[model samples]
Target: MTEVRCPLCKTVPEHGRKWDYGERTTVQCAVCGFYTITGTAVSIAERQNISHKLSAYTRDNTERGVDVPEINSNNLSQLQTSLPDYGVGDKQLLYMRALERRSKFPGSLVQVTPGIDYPLAWASGEEEFLYLLRDLLSRRLVAVPEGGTKALREDVSFETLITPAGWEYLEKHRAVSAISDQVFVAMSFSPNLQAAWEDAIRPAIVESGYKPYRIDDEPHVDRIDSKIIAEIRNSGFLVADVTEQRPGVYFEAGFALGLGLKVFWCVRSDDLEHVHFDTRQYNHIVWETEADLKEKLFYFVTSVAGKRTAT
Candidate 1:
């Protein structure tokens, strides 16, 4: 009828297109690419179109669902009969990405290393991310309750319904294809941090022979932390580039320690100035140039097998 709202900028537009999901009317903005999904006018929800949001979330919780035989004591004996062959959820997507780019060396799954740096994947928290794809294939609505890089990951598989609507959404978006599985030098960065991070550590981390990973799963799609946690925990050594005094980095460091892996810490001097005495006093590497970070990170990371077991 009248103009709907824009998806990128949620303002009622002079002209837009209305896309309906049969039962509901979803509008897309012709001028600004904003649209409406579900019943929400969508302007109240800036950077979100109504129709797009509707596709992602249910009218209730807005999470994606999985199609598989869920495990239950009532039917435990039929495990094999229930399990499917390929349930490539987010983690498997990450693994697939890791596999795609990794060198064709034996022991690659464990040793090929990663390529992108997706903070969301890390932010998925431990339990939620551990062996996540496998869980997502079998369950639905894996959740990160705390809402940050350090929230608790809990699977909501038990309380979901597998719907064809979600599969349609996934097919249209190819959310599976967008995850970044490359290893990155993590820093609490904004636009300013990007330059500094790339300049100081990005190349070096790459030089140190790590492929970074990024997670770009659609919001309602499954976000499993299983394989991620398993990879990080089982990693022979972890290097936390603590350039920023971030709680999430500390959480990952603690996770590394809990796993009893060798942790190579790094920080910029200015940033290092702000770190707590407990962290500052620790034997962390201080690097001003990529060469130094690369030299040291490579020396340590490459020597992990000789220095530490792949436990």
Candidate 2:
């Protein structure tokens, strides 16, 4: 056992180890008693450095007859692809370019300088220079031998340049960042009031200062495994319609309540009797017409936003 600095905990703490194959691996987190494969860019860089240092440390200890063994390296190449872009500017574009250009040779090596031609391709935009450098240095989770790629292309081009995953990522990034920056009061909402709830109601919810990002307008959001649940949990509030007792929407509303978020429950007048018992604790607002709905919804959202801001 050895004391290690857990990135999440930010302290040198107790750790355990196990032997897998011929390699020795350290426990992830002893205190938390759990393991998580995910990491922030900085954390990955730190762990990579730790892994390298530990390998060397093991070598030195082995020579001293301390019975130290090598740590099996985790493949971080896929994680290198791209997490969500939280930083501002074209960092993501530059990163995607780097990933697409990055090549792996024998011995599970990372080649940064091989046929990439990153520099030449990025020549049109010099601003990306800083973004590229920052990620390269900070997110150096794996060794990228510059000599392997040979150097970045001055004009290596891309096709379409706007992948569906890219667009979905951008939208999610904006929504999540907006919530963080207090740009808009982020709230979960739904307008699905009838058989047409999927159509008419959802957009209206979005238009009411609430982003229905969970319903991902673009069909591409699922591929990247975008953190939709995280976004919903971090929202300013939650609102839902129960006209048809939509199972999915009802679940979302319930989930939000469990998270302790203030909720606004609305339903169509026709199905008022069918409203479930738990949700019926609070009387659901019923709008008779589109004009009535708009006015009521506008006021409800506006009031909720006001209460949130005041607090």
Best by TM-score: 2
- Please identify model 1 stretches exceeding 4 Å from their true place: 1-185, 196-202, 214-231, 303-311
Predicted candidate 1 versus true structure: per-residue lDDT over 121-142, tens digit per residue: 2212234344553353344322
Clashes of 1: 41
**Could you tell me the C-alpha RMSD of candidate 1 in Å?**
19.3
What does candidate 2's lDDT look like per residue over 1-311, in tens digits?
Answer: 54545433333435544344433334334222222223343255466544222222222233223432212234343322222223433444434433433423222433232112222223213344434543443444222344422233433322212234544444444312232212111222344433234443444555554554444443433322223333444464665766666676677677656644556677767878888887788856686665566567667665544413221
lDDT of 1: 0.40
TM-score of every prediction relative to native: 0.35, 0.43
lDDT of each: 0.40, 0.42
Every model: Cα RMSD to truth: 19.3, 17.4
